[model samples]
Target: MIDLLKEKQAVLDVQPAQSGASFAPVLPVDIEARAVSKRFGDTPIFSDVSFRLARGEATALVGANGTGKSTLLRCLMGLIPTSGGSVHLLGQQANTATGRELRNMRAQVGLVSQKHNLVPRLSVLSNVVHGLLGRRPGMRHWSQALAPQSSRDAAMQALERVGLADFANRRADRLSGGQSQRVAIARAIVSAPKVLFADEPCASLDPSAGEDVMELFFQLVRDEAVTVVFTSHNIEHALKYGDRVLGLAQGRIQLDATAASLSAAELRGLYD
Candidate 1:
């Protein structure tokens, strides 16, 4: 017999399931930022910030506006060069890597920005297939427009995992904010990255929608056992969802502790 009550309960619950698979003991990935600094010509945005992100963990970076959070993410992603020091991803020196090497490194890392980066003109399935583009070295422009049947199947599965399978044929730009965010997440995970970086993923959503999106993120991290690092301005959300909370002020890490370890008062001090 079908259990209607259980199905209904599943729809209401937002908490992610705990990881049950035991990961093999491997050398921890050393994601380190050593004395990193950034500047736009003469205007310095951040200076002498350093931190390390260990493998197989979730870390939340929290701060006020203009605290260099986005700049730090860009630096980590190697989108922009830092003025001083360096960033190392999985033990590879990001500062010295060539374009090809950097692209290789980026393949292992996934990013979901505040602004959804989906191709508006494409169908939802096509946008998800973009995750596979990093794997195809020579495929680009019009040549890559027609995704293979296998890739299309994979994209459909990804959308199904995010509960958007029914909308696979819809245009990405036509979806609601929450649905768009889920599609963005589906695209990120389709590549099966080792680490996922989200920059204020729920910044534009309403309270309920934000919670729904965050719930999906947590589920992805736990189910896939992918390392997650995100930046957010929402303290309550950080406290509720983050495994490890990092408070950044003035472009430096001021507090690093488990979410359970930080009291409300302590969190306020970090923000202040």
Candidate 2:
């Protein structure tokens, strides 16, 4: 198996520390949102929201249905344009970034949503290799035949990290729901994103399977030192897995604190 730590070191080599008097020091925050809001026509989804994700930490967003948790996550990932405010992801301003800049910035950010979003017909390893498509200049996405050895190594390493290296050749559609989710995560990690955004990652799994997936996800993030921001409707899962929790209600953050400092009983009160 490829050494994940060594690969991580190689990845870090590309990210040299900035210096010189004219260059401003970079913020430690991996993600920063200030006075952010989202709306569809006249209907406001959320307003005046702000938060920061510290490096190598996991922040969970919890709320009832219609509370805009997913919408807010999408906004942070720059998948959708926000109605107001500003967002800086990995020090790149989302609002004014050019297409090429956004593309490059996006390569450093990974996302896993409720849907597995895998190409069912492809082998699990190939699906993970797709994560490098953007990173590979002028390469045809579907031409897996032309994938370089480095890309294959990274993909295999990602699968190894997710405990799916043995199933690299299996078709994505043949995997179980839980396995599919893991594969999606492997795809996300193959990109070696500094920040990983998961939207209700366990929503489709059975209780036991969901718990297992959550455990794997948290461990992977911790080992890889990737910052994570995820939204979950499962209060127990959020309280159990998150280092920090942000409770959203009626377009506002009703509560924000370390998960250890908050109890399930207190979180339930927000729902009522």
Candidate 3:
């Protein structure tokens, strides 16, 4: 059963599940920020920031507070417009795409933030089902009670991936900090998104809980072969979980290096 699930998951991740299995090819460059820049009024947030994320790549965005890491992330996701340059996602010009086109592109993307953002009154299963809203809308997705069987099953599979299947029926408010974060991760991956964007995802947890959640989160990301772009205040996480590190400082990309080639000390220097 485990092997079967693994095989099925690879298909959801757009990879070939097994020998001779049909596959969908993701573009070589999943995300590209071409000299993008942002500003709020006269205050510049970031300028000339650019990077490309390949399919299934994991990159970490690291920086000191107020360097606009979050702003840059939002721009990359097309949640906000860049002041200059452009962002391309999944073969479309994200910033220039039509409304429907942008929505369609975003349907294949997922997000996880520091806050769990779960509906406290709802069951964990229902919260996970909500991740499908970008693709599956209307009252049917409002709760597990109204959700179709297929939706429920997908939500459960996502819960299982985060090791929270047993808590599917529990209320979202009844979970521990670590458990809530797990549910958040399950929600993000429920749609088998081509790319996952996480902004300080562990920022709200204590050290011990944060460490545990980050481990589980990255492990699941690897198992599903998902591309990821996450911002981290923790240098250890930046080096440990990412294939490449994109550092922000002085209103620009101060450092862009392979994580394998970057020492912790060198990355820490960017924070100074």
Assess candidate 2 and give its TM-score to the true structure: 0.87
Native-to-model Cα distance after best TM-score fit, residue 235 in candidate 3, in Å: 0.3
**Candidate 3 accuracy as TM-score:** 0.89
Stretches off by above 4 angstroms in model 3 are 1-27
Clashing pairs in 3: none
Ranked by TM-score from best down, the candidates are 3, 2, 1
Model 1: what TM-score? 0.85
Per-residue lDDT of 1-272 in model 2, one digit per residue for the tens? 11332243345336577677787545489888899999999998998988787888789898888989998888887888889998898998886677899899888988887799999988898888888876775564443556877788889899998899999989999999999999999988887889999999999999888898999999988988899999997888888889888878778776667787667776776676
In candidate 1 the C-alpha lDDT for residue 77 amounts to: 80
lDDT of 3 by residue, 75-114 (tens): 8888988899999988888888878898899999999999
- Alpha carbon deviation, residue 80, candidate 3 (Å): 0.9
Which one wins on TM-score?
Answer: 3
Winner by lDDT: 3
